[model samples]
Target: MITLVRTNDIVLISLIEALLREARVPLFVADAHVSAVEGSIGAFPRRVMVPEDHAAQARRLLRDAGLGAELAPSPGGS
Candidate 1:
């Protein structure tokens, strides 16, 4: 999996999740339960991830939706 976005903003994560779902892109949210363990202090940022094969398309989708600034750098540095 590749990290597409990582942040403490739950709203942004939800919005991105919806966008990805609407576009039919598979995704997984990492560290989502950390908040429960950490009392919602927001220290651990949740991560949005997609399969390696779908990273580029997912990044493009988020970028087009005015979320380019939230995108994580690709593993290959592209």
Candidate 2:
């Protein structure tokens, strides 16, 4: 899986999850358990990831949804 976004904003994460689900793209919320364990501190943010094969489509979908700025930098800094 490739991470598309990491954030402490539960609202943003929910929005992304909704978008991914509606589009039928696979979604994973990493570090969610960690956040729960940590009591939702601003540390150890939750990550939104998609399957590698769907990453481009997911990224495009998110960017179109006005979330480009929230996207993680592409691997290799591209």
Candidate 3:
């Protein structure tokens, strides 16, 4: 899997999750539970990830949803 977005904004995370789920893209939100260890002070951001096979489609889907700016930088040098 590859990360597509990472942030402390739960709203944004939820939006991405819903979008991906609706599109049937494989999804995983890593570090989602780390807030418990960090006292939910926004110390650790959650990550939105998709299977490598879905990466391109997921990125396009998110961009179409106006979340292009929120995407993690493409893996350096491809």
C-alpha positional error of residue 55 in candidate 1 after TM-score superposition, expressed in Å: 0.6
lDDT score at residue 53, model 2, on the 0-100 scale: 92
- TM for candidate 1 is 0.93
TM-score, each model? Answer: 0.93, 0.93, 0.90
1-78, model 3: which lDDT tens digit per residue? 999998989899999999999999989999978855787688888899998889999999999999999999877533
- List residue ranges in candidate 1 displaced over 4 A: none
What is the C-alpha RMSD, rounded to one decimal, of candidate 2? Answer: 1.1
> In candidate 2, which residue pairs clash?
none
Ranking by lDDT: 2, 1, 3
Per residue, candidate 1 scores C-alpha lDDT tens digits across 1-78 of 999999889899999999999989999999989855886678889999999998988999988999999999999887
For each predicted model, how many residue pairs clash, with residues at least 3 apart or on different chains?
A: 0, 0, 0
Candidate 2, residues 1-78, lDDT tens digits: the string is: 989999989999999999999999999999998887888568889999998899889999999999999999877575
Q: How many steric clashes does model 1 contain?
A: 0
> Would you list the C-alpha lDDT of every candidate in the order shown?
0.91, 0.92, 0.89
> Better model by lDDT, 2 or 3?
2
